[model samples]
Target: MGIITGGTRQGHEPELTGVVIRSSAGHLLVAVDGTIWRCQMRGRLKRGKRQSQTVAVVGDRVRIGAQDPHAEPPRGVLEEVLPRTNRISRMAARRTGGHVEQVLMANLDQVVAVQSIAEPRPQTGFVDRLLVAAERFGVAGVLVLNKADLPEPADQKTMWDYFVSMGYKVLRTSAETGQGGPQLADLLKDRVSLLIGASGVGKSSLLNLVEPGLRLRVGEVTGKTGLGRHTTTSTELFPLAGGGFIADSPGIRGFDPWAIAPRDVRDYFPDFAEPQQACRFRTCLHRDEPVCGVKEAVAKGRIPRWRLAAYLSLLGDLEERAERLGPRKRP
Candidate 1:
C-alpha cells in the first residue's frame, strides 16, 4: 500500500469498495467488510445530478477514493456507482423532482413491510402501494404485522386475511414477546432484505430482537403525530451472522406517488391484468370510462375498490405531473 495521499488524484484514484449503509449530514457512510468509511460527494457525483438530493443514497455499491484521514474533517471522493440488480424507488419529492426516481434501496432480494396491529393501525392502501412497487422491481415483499402481543382488531384481521389470500408472506411479530422471531430469522437467511414501514411500527425493535448485537436505537412513537421519531438516522446495510444484509431505513410516514409512468402503473398491481384487459377502452384508466371491466368488477365486488382506487390515485399523480412538466422541448 502506498503512503498517505493528500488531495484528489483522478489520475491515480484511491478506489475503495463499499455498499452505502447510510446517507446523513450530506455524507454517506459506506461499508466494505466491517469498517465503514465516511465519504463526501465528488465533483463528478455532484455534477451528475445538477438538481437533486445530494450524492449517494443508501444501498448503492460504489468505488470511493479515500482522502486524508488527518484532515480536520475527513472526506473521501466517490468515484463510481455500480449497476444495481434491482432498486426500490418512490416519486421524487423535491423541486428537482421530474420523472427522476429517488431510489430508496438498491439490490434487495426482499422487502418486509412492518405494520402495527393496533395503536397506529395498519394501512392496507399503503401496504398495497408498497406491494406494487415491489412487483415492479421484481423483488419479493412480505407483510410483517408487528406488535402481535397486542390484539388484532377486526380491520387489521381483514387486512391480514386479504393479503394472505393474495399470496403475500405475512408475519405476526411481537418485538416484546419475541413472537415470529425464528420465522423472520429463517426468511432473512442468505437474502439481502429491506425492512420498510410507517414510522413507530417497531422496525428497530424487531431488528434488535433479531440481532441482539445490533442494538439500534429505538424511537418513541409520538402520539401527536402518530409517527416514530427519527431513530435509524441514516440508511445503512447491516450484516446478519446467518448470512444476509438488512437496510434499516429512517422513518417513512407517507409514501408519495411521483415519477412513475401511467401506462406502467397497472402492471405493478398484479391483480389488474386478466380483468383490466377486458376494460372497454384498451387504455381505460378504469375511472370514468364507460363499461370499464374494472369499474364493473368493483360494482360486483369482484375486485376491491381500495385496490382500484390506489391505481387511479397513482395514475392521476403521474398524469398531473406530466401536464405540469409539459413536453420537454427539443432544442
Candidate 2:
C-alpha cells in the first residue's frame, strides 16, 4: 500500500482509472474514461529499479491520483500501470552494448505496417524485419500499402499478392483518393492497432484520411531524397471515431530485432514457422547448415529470396556478436 505524501490537506485523493495517451516532456497525458489528465512520474517511484526506463507509453492502462482533478484541465502523478497484454518495442538505443530498450508502445493488439507505394519506394526487407519482431512477440501483423495514387511505380500488384497469399491482411489505401479508408477503418474498429513504417510512407497522411478530423501535422517529402520529413517525434494513442484505438510512433526506416537472439530469428518468418522443423539439423541456423529446408525453400521459389537474405543477414549479425562477446576474459 502507498501512503499519500500529503500534498493535499483535506484528504488523500482517490486513484482514477486511465489509459496513457502519450508520454512526453516528462508529462503523461492519460485519458481517464471520457476525460484526460496531465501526469508526472514521481521521483520516488522512479527509484528502486526499472524493468525498463520507459515506464509509461501510449496504450498503457494506469491509475491516476491528483489533489486537484479539473475536468477540462487535469494534473496528477501516475501512481501505477496495469499489466499489459502485449507490447511493441524496437532495438532501444544503447551505449555499453549488451542491450538497451526504448518501448514505443504497450498493449498493442496489432501493427499496421504502412508501406508507401512511392516517394520512398517500399522496402521489403524493412517490412519483413518488423514482422519478424511482431511474430516473436506474438502480436498480430497487418500491412498497409499507402500512396497508391502516384505515377507508374514498381511493386504494385506483385507485392500485394505476396503478403496476402502469406495469410497476412493488406490494405491498399491512397490518402489522396480515399481508396481503402473504410476497409482499413473497419479492420481497426475494435482493436489496438499501432501504425509503423518508413519515414516517407505517408503514415500521418493516411491517418488523416482515415479520419479527416484528426488533422495531424503532415510533412512534405524531401526534394533531394524523395523521402518524408519527420513530423511525428513521439508516440500517441488516438481513439478512433469508429471503435478501437490507434497508436502512432516515430518513423522506423529500419528495425533491428532489439535484443532478440539470432538463433531464434528464423522462427519469426511466417513461412518459416512451419517448415523450420523440417531442417536436417534441429539446431540449423538455416544459412549453411546441411539440408536446411528454409534455404532450400527459397531456392525452389517456395519462400521469397529477399526474405531469406534478410534472415541470413540477421543471423550473421547475431553470430558475429556472440563471437565478439565470447567468454569475457577475467580482469
Candidate 3:
C-alpha cells in the first residue's frame, strides 16, 4: 500500500526499510517483511561520482518508498542506501582510461573460499588470492576443500596442514557423502557468509546439501578446458533455515583485489606479516633482499615454498597494476 502524503513536500511521505536481495544493471529486488519488491534506484544514487561499478549489491540495506498496491508484483522507488559494514571487491578489468572497483558482495561477516580436491583440480593460486582479498576487505576467510568423496591427492594433506598452521579455518567437505556438512553449517550459522570459487568447484552443490530447499543449478567442468561452466549468472542471497544469510556469487575466472599498493601486499598475507618484522631492512619485500627473514623461513621449511610463490605472483600483479594506474590518491 502506498503511503498517502498530505502535501507535495518530500518529507511528507513515509519510507519503508528493506535489504537488497538481488541487483542487476538497473533494477533490484528488495525484501521487506515477507514481500519482495522490485525497485528502481533514485537518480541521485546512480549519478554520484564513484569508482564502484554498481550502486547497490546484494546484502545492502536500503530505505524505499511505499509500493503501489495495484501493481502486479509490487514496485517501489529506492531512496537511500544504508552504510555497509564491509564488502568484498576486486579491481575490474582495466578500461581505456582507468580501473574501477567491482563490488562482489556487501556486508559480509565471513567469506568461504571453496576449492575442490579433484575433478577440476585445485588451484592454489586462486585460493590464496581469494583469501588475501577477503583479508584486505576486512572479512574473515574460511577455506573449504570440497569433493572429499574422491580420493585425496598426495599434496592435499600437506596443503591442509599449511593453512591450519597459519590459523585459517579449513574444512574438507563431501557433498555426496555428507562428510563435513555439519561443521560447515556450524561455521555459517548466524553469520552472513559469501561463497566464492571458480566454476565446477561444487559451490552450488554444497549449498544445496547444506540448505536442502535451495535447488541451485549446478554445472560440470568442461571436458576440453577442464574449467567449470558459469552456473550462477548473478549474485543472490538465501536465508538459511537455522539462522543467518548466505550469498552465492557467480564463479570468478580471475580475481585481483582493488586499491592494493605494491609495498603493502605483505600486510594482506597474515603469515608473512610477522616474519617480515624480523627482516634485515625495514622495507624488505621478502624478495631479492639479503638477510631476509622470510627467505630464511622458507629455506628452513617454516613456510611452504608454494605459498611464497603465490605471494610473489600477487606482488608482481600488484606492481604491474600500480604502474598502469599510477599512484592511488587517498580517498
TM-score of each: 0.87, 0.89, 0.93
- Candidate 2 segments exceeding 4 Å error: 1-11, 48-51, 94-98, 151-156, 320-331
Estimate, for each residue in 270-318, the C-alpha lDDT of model 3 and write its tens digit.
8887777789999899899999989888999888999999999989988
The models' CA-based lDDT, in order, is 0.75, 0.77, 0.84
lDDT of 2 by residue, 68-140 (tens): 6765577888887889887777655434243445677777889889988778888757877788778877789
Best by lDDT: 3
Residue 46 CA error for candidate 1 (Å)? 0.8
**Which 10 consecutive positions of candidate 2 have the poorest summed lDDT?**
1-10
Best candidate, TM-score-wise?
3
Q: Against the hidden true structure, what lDDT does model 3 obtain?
A: 0.84
Q: Could you tell me which residue pairs clash in candidate 1?
A: 21-235, 21-236, 22-235, 91-258
Report the CA-based lDDT of candidate 2 relative to the real structure: 0.77
Residues 244-282, candidate 1: write the lDDT tens digits.
888888767656543456777787776677778788788
Worst 10-residue stretch by lDDT in candidate 3? 1-10
